[model samples]
Target: MEQNYLAPAETMQIHELLNFKTICMTSSKMMEGVVFDQELKTLFEKDVRQSITAINDLQVLLGKAPKLR
Candidate 1:
Protein backbone atom coordinates (compact mmCIF):
# COMPACT_ATOMS: atom_id res chain seq x y z
CA MET A 1 0.00 0.00 0.00
CA GLU A 2 1.21 3.48 -0.78
CA GLN A 3 1.15 6.13 1.92
CA ASN A 4 -0.14 9.56 0.99
CA TYR A 5 2.33 11.37 3.25
CA LEU A 6 6.04 10.69 3.40
CA ALA A 7 7.79 9.66 6.61
CA PRO A 8 9.95 12.31 8.22
CA ALA A 9 13.19 10.75 6.97
CA GLU A 10 11.81 10.34 3.48
CA THR A 11 10.58 13.94 3.54
CA MET A 12 14.06 15.15 4.45
CA GLN A 13 15.57 13.16 1.62
CA ILE A 14 13.12 14.62 -0.86
CA HIS A 15 13.82 18.12 0.42
CA GLU A 16 17.56 17.62 -0.06
CA LEU A 17 17.03 16.22 -3.55
CA LEU A 18 14.92 19.25 -4.44
CA ASN A 19 17.61 21.62 -3.26
CA PHE A 20 20.34 19.77 -5.15
CA LYS A 21 18.31 19.60 -8.35
CA THR A 22 17.52 23.32 -8.18
CA ILE A 23 21.20 24.17 -7.80
CA CYS A 24 22.10 21.96 -10.76
CA MET A 25 19.36 23.48 -12.92
CA THR A 26 20.41 27.02 -12.03
CA SER A 27 24.07 26.33 -12.77
CA SER A 28 23.28 24.70 -16.12
CA LYS A 29 21.04 27.62 -17.12
CA MET A 30 23.78 30.11 -16.21
CA MET A 31 26.30 28.25 -18.34
CA GLU A 32 24.04 27.74 -21.36
CA GLY A 33 24.09 31.41 -22.42
CA VAL A 34 27.81 32.08 -22.04
CA VAL A 35 28.97 28.76 -23.51
CA PHE A 36 30.77 29.31 -26.84
CA ASP A 37 30.52 25.76 -28.24
CA GLN A 38 27.23 24.81 -29.83
CA GLU A 39 27.38 21.20 -28.62
CA LEU A 40 28.24 22.25 -25.06
CA LYS A 41 25.39 24.75 -25.02
CA THR A 42 22.98 22.04 -26.18
CA LEU A 43 24.26 19.74 -23.44
CA PHE A 44 23.65 22.39 -20.80
CA GLU A 45 20.16 22.97 -22.11
CA LYS A 46 19.41 19.26 -21.81
CA ASP A 47 20.76 19.12 -18.27
CA VAL A 48 18.66 22.12 -17.30
CA ARG A 49 15.52 20.47 -18.64
CA GLN A 50 16.22 17.16 -16.92
CA SER A 51 16.99 18.86 -13.63
CA ILE A 52 13.75 20.80 -13.79
CA THR A 53 11.79 17.60 -14.33
CA ALA A 54 13.49 15.90 -11.41
CA ILE A 55 12.91 18.89 -9.14
CA ASN A 56 9.23 18.94 -10.00
CA ASP A 57 8.86 15.25 -9.25
CA LEU A 58 10.63 15.64 -5.92
CA GLN A 59 8.45 18.60 -5.00
CA VAL A 60 5.34 16.51 -5.63
CA LEU A 61 6.57 13.97 -3.11
CA LEU A 62 7.38 16.74 -0.62
CA GLY A 63 3.96 18.41 -0.91
CA LYS A 64 3.55 22.08 0.04
CA ALA A 65 6.62 23.47 1.77
CA PRO A 66 6.38 25.56 4.95
CA LYS A 67 5.93 29.32 5.05
CA LEU A 68 7.70 31.66 7.49
CA ARG A 69 4.43 33.36 8.37
Candidate 2:
Protein backbone atom coordinates (compact mmCIF):
# COMPACT_ATOMS: atom_id res chain seq x y z
CA MET A 1 0.00 0.00 0.00
CA GLU A 2 1.18 3.48 -0.77
CA GLN A 3 1.73 5.77 2.17
CA ASN A 4 -0.19 9.06 2.40
CA TYR A 5 0.97 11.94 4.53
CA LEU A 6 0.13 15.65 4.77
CA ALA A 7 2.69 18.42 4.91
CA PRO A 8 2.68 20.71 7.98
CA ALA A 9 0.86 23.50 6.16
CA GLU A 10 -1.72 21.15 4.74
CA THR A 11 -2.26 19.67 8.15
CA MET A 12 -2.86 23.08 9.65
CA GLN A 13 -5.30 24.01 6.91
CA ILE A 14 -7.23 20.83 7.47
CA HIS A 15 -7.40 21.50 11.18
CA GLU A 16 -8.78 24.97 10.55
CA LEU A 17 -11.36 23.65 8.10
CA LEU A 18 -12.44 20.99 10.56
CA ASN A 19 -12.92 23.58 13.27
CA PHE A 20 -14.89 25.87 10.99
CA LYS A 21 -17.17 23.06 9.87
CA THR A 22 -17.87 22.01 13.43
CA ILE A 23 -18.84 25.56 14.33
CA CYS A 24 -21.10 25.84 11.30
CA MET A 25 -22.80 22.55 12.09
CA THR A 26 -23.42 23.58 15.66
CA SER A 27 -24.88 26.90 14.60
CA SER A 28 -27.21 25.29 12.08
CA LYS A 29 -28.45 22.78 14.61
CA MET A 30 -29.16 25.49 17.14
CA MET A 31 -30.91 27.70 14.62
CA GLU A 32 -33.17 24.84 13.57
CA GLY A 33 -34.90 24.99 16.95
CA VAL A 34 -35.88 28.67 16.69
CA VAL A 35 -36.41 29.17 12.99
CA PHE A 36 -40.05 29.74 12.04
CA ASP A 37 -39.85 29.51 8.25
CA GLN A 38 -40.08 26.05 6.76
CA GLU A 39 -37.80 26.89 3.83
CA LEU A 40 -35.17 28.37 6.11
CA LYS A 41 -35.35 25.38 8.40
CA THR A 42 -34.84 23.05 5.45
CA LEU A 43 -31.80 25.02 4.37
CA PHE A 44 -30.30 24.77 7.81
CA GLU A 45 -30.93 21.03 7.85
CA LYS A 46 -29.15 20.61 4.55
CA ASP A 47 -26.22 22.69 5.77
CA VAL A 48 -25.96 20.58 8.91
CA ARG A 49 -25.85 17.36 6.88
CA GLN A 50 -23.23 18.70 4.50
CA SER A 51 -21.13 19.97 7.38
CA ILE A 52 -21.24 16.57 9.01
CA THR A 53 -19.94 14.94 5.85
CA ALA A 54 -17.19 17.54 5.42
CA ILE A 55 -16.14 17.19 9.05
CA ASN A 56 -15.87 13.41 8.72
CA ASP A 57 -13.77 13.68 5.58
CA LEU A 58 -11.52 16.22 7.25
CA GLN A 59 -11.04 13.96 10.27
CA VAL A 60 -9.91 11.11 8.05
CA LEU A 61 -7.40 13.36 6.31
CA LEU A 62 -6.14 14.69 9.64
CA GLY A 63 -5.63 11.15 10.90
CA LYS A 64 -3.32 10.43 7.97
CA ALA A 65 -1.10 13.41 8.81
CA PRO A 66 2.22 12.78 10.51
CA LYS A 67 2.32 13.33 14.25
CA LEU A 68 4.35 16.23 15.53
CA ARG A 69 7.25 15.58 17.90
Candidate 3:
Protein backbone atom coordinates (compact mmCIF):
# COMPACT_ATOMS: atom_id res chain seq x y z
CA MET A 1 0.00 0.00 0.00
CA GLU A 2 1.09 3.53 -0.80
CA GLN A 3 -0.10 6.93 0.21
CA ASN A 4 0.69 10.35 -1.21
CA TYR A 5 0.72 13.69 0.55
CA LEU A 6 1.59 17.11 -0.83
CA ALA A 7 2.76 20.31 0.81
CA PRO A 8 3.07 23.82 -0.58
CA ALA A 9 6.48 25.16 -1.63
CA GLU A 10 6.66 27.63 1.26
CA THR A 11 5.94 24.86 3.71
CA MET A 12 8.63 22.71 2.10
CA GLN A 13 11.13 25.53 2.38
CA ILE A 14 10.39 25.98 6.09
CA HIS A 15 10.76 22.25 6.64
CA GLU A 16 14.14 22.26 4.90
CA LEU A 17 15.34 25.13 7.05
CA LEU A 18 14.37 23.27 10.20
CA ASN A 19 16.17 20.16 8.97
CA PHE A 20 19.28 22.17 8.23
CA LYS A 21 19.31 23.48 11.80
CA THR A 22 19.05 19.94 13.15
CA ILE A 23 21.90 18.76 10.92
CA CYS A 24 24.07 21.64 12.05
CA MET A 25 23.49 20.81 15.71
CA THR A 26 24.17 17.10 15.14
CA SER A 27 27.35 17.79 13.22
CA SER A 28 28.66 20.27 15.74
CA LYS A 29 28.04 17.85 18.59
CA MET A 30 29.48 14.74 16.90
CA MET A 31 32.40 16.22 14.95
CA GLU A 32 35.26 18.22 16.36
CA GLY A 33 36.22 19.96 13.14
CA VAL A 34 32.80 20.63 11.70
CA VAL A 35 32.16 24.32 11.06
CA PHE A 36 29.00 26.32 11.30
CA ASP A 37 27.51 27.53 7.99
CA GLN A 38 26.37 30.89 9.24
CA GLU A 39 28.17 34.22 9.72
CA LEU A 40 26.77 34.55 13.23
CA LYS A 41 29.31 32.25 14.88
CA THR A 42 31.89 34.97 15.15
CA LEU A 43 29.27 37.35 16.49
CA PHE A 44 28.17 34.78 19.04
CA GLU A 45 31.71 34.11 20.13
CA LYS A 46 32.33 37.79 20.61
CA ASP A 47 29.14 38.16 22.57
CA VAL A 48 30.07 35.27 24.84
CA ARG A 49 33.53 36.64 25.43
CA GLN A 50 32.13 40.02 26.23
CA SER A 51 29.71 38.51 28.69
CA ILE A 52 32.52 36.67 30.45
CA THR A 53 34.59 39.82 30.64
CA ALA A 54 31.65 41.72 32.09
CA ILE A 55 31.13 39.07 34.74
CA ASN A 56 34.77 39.20 35.68
CA ASP A 57 34.63 42.97 35.92
CA LEU A 58 31.57 42.84 38.14
CA GLN A 59 33.21 40.26 40.34
CA VAL A 60 36.13 42.63 40.87
CA LEU A 61 33.79 45.59 41.44
CA LEU A 62 31.81 43.84 44.19
CA GLY A 63 34.84 42.28 45.87
CA LYS A 64 33.71 38.68 45.20
CA ALA A 65 29.94 39.37 44.78
CA PRO A 66 27.10 39.79 47.32
CA LYS A 67 26.80 36.06 47.95
CA LEU A 68 29.82 36.38 50.25
CA ARG A 69 27.67 38.76 52.35
Candidate 4:
Protein backbone atom coordinates (compact mmCIF):
# COMPACT_ATOMS: atom_id res chain seq x y z
CA MET A 1 0.00 0.00 0.00
CA GLU A 2 1.17 3.48 -0.81
CA GLN A 3 1.64 5.35 2.44
CA ASN A 4 1.13 8.96 1.53
CA TYR A 5 1.58 11.58 4.24
CA LEU A 6 -1.66 13.15 5.45
CA ALA A 7 -2.30 16.80 4.79
CA PRO A 8 -3.58 18.97 7.63
CA ALA A 9 -7.24 18.71 6.64
CA GLU A 10 -7.01 14.99 6.07
CA THR A 11 -5.32 14.51 9.42
CA MET A 12 -8.04 16.49 11.15
CA GLN A 13 -10.77 14.49 9.44
CA ILE A 14 -9.08 11.26 10.48
CA HIS A 15 -8.90 12.51 14.03
CA GLU A 16 -12.64 13.15 13.99
CA LEU A 17 -13.35 9.75 12.52
CA LEU A 18 -11.16 8.10 15.14
CA ASN A 19 -13.01 9.87 17.92
CA PHE A 20 -16.38 8.86 16.53
CA LYS A 21 -15.24 5.30 16.05
CA THR A 22 -13.97 5.13 19.59
CA ILE A 23 -17.26 6.37 20.98
CA CYS A 24 -19.24 3.90 18.88
CA MET A 25 -17.02 0.98 19.81
CA THR A 26 -17.00 1.89 23.48
CA SER A 27 -20.78 2.33 23.62
CA SER A 28 -21.34 -1.04 21.99
CA LYS A 29 -19.09 -2.70 24.54
CA MET A 30 -20.71 -0.94 27.47
CA MET A 31 -24.16 -1.81 26.20
CA GLU A 32 -23.32 -5.50 26.57
CA GLY A 33 -23.37 -5.16 30.35
CA VAL A 34 -26.98 -3.92 30.47
CA VAL A 35 -28.44 -5.84 27.56
CA PHE A 36 -30.27 -8.94 28.83
CA ASP A 37 -31.95 -10.23 25.70
CA GLN A 38 -29.90 -12.68 23.70
CA GLU A 39 -30.88 -11.20 20.35
CA LEU A 40 -30.07 -7.69 21.49
CA LYS A 41 -26.80 -8.85 22.94
CA THR A 42 -25.97 -10.48 19.65
CA LEU A 43 -26.80 -7.27 17.85
CA PHE A 44 -24.60 -5.31 20.18
CA GLU A 45 -21.76 -7.75 19.61
CA LYS A 46 -22.19 -7.42 15.88
CA ASP A 47 -22.07 -3.65 16.16
CA VAL A 48 -18.95 -3.92 18.26
CA ARG A 49 -17.33 -6.09 15.60
CA GLN A 50 -18.27 -3.62 12.88
CA SER A 51 -16.96 -0.72 14.88
CA ILE A 52 -13.71 -2.58 15.43
CA THR A 53 -13.40 -3.22 11.71
CA ALA A 54 -14.12 0.42 10.94
CA ILE A 55 -11.63 1.58 13.52
CA ASN A 56 -9.01 -0.76 12.10
CA ASP A 57 -9.62 0.55 8.62
CA LEU A 58 -9.45 4.11 9.85
CA GLN A 59 -6.23 3.40 11.69
CA VAL A 60 -4.74 2.03 8.50
CA LEU A 61 -5.78 5.18 6.70
CA LEU A 62 -4.27 7.23 9.48
CA GLY A 63 -1.06 5.28 9.09
CA LYS A 64 -1.15 5.65 5.34
CA ALA A 65 -2.30 9.23 5.85
CA PRO A 66 -3.85 9.92 2.51
CA LYS A 67 -4.25 13.50 1.41
CA LEU A 68 -7.55 13.11 -0.40
CA ARG A 69 -8.81 16.17 -2.21
Write down the lDDT of every candidate, Cα atoms only: 0.84, 0.96, 0.47, 0.88
Candidate 4 lDDT by residue in tens digits, 15-38: 899999899889989999999999
For residue 69, what is the lDDT in candidate 4? 82
Candidate 3 lDDT, 1-69, residue by residue in tens = 754333455445545654554455444444433447445555554555554555455434434222322
TM-score of 1: 0.83
- Model 3 stretches with alpha carbons more than 4 Å out: 1-36, 64-69
TM-score of each: 0.83, 0.92, 0.38, 0.81
Q: Which candidate is the best by TM-score?
A: 2
Rank list by TM-score: 2, 1, 4, 3
lDDT, candidate 1, equals 0.84
- Residue-level lDDT tens digits of model 2 in 1-69: 998899989999999999999999999999999999999999999999999999999999999899878
Off by over 4 Å in 4: 1-3, 66-69
Would you give me the overall lDDT of model 2?
A: 0.96
Number of the predicted model whose lDDT against the real structure is largest: 2
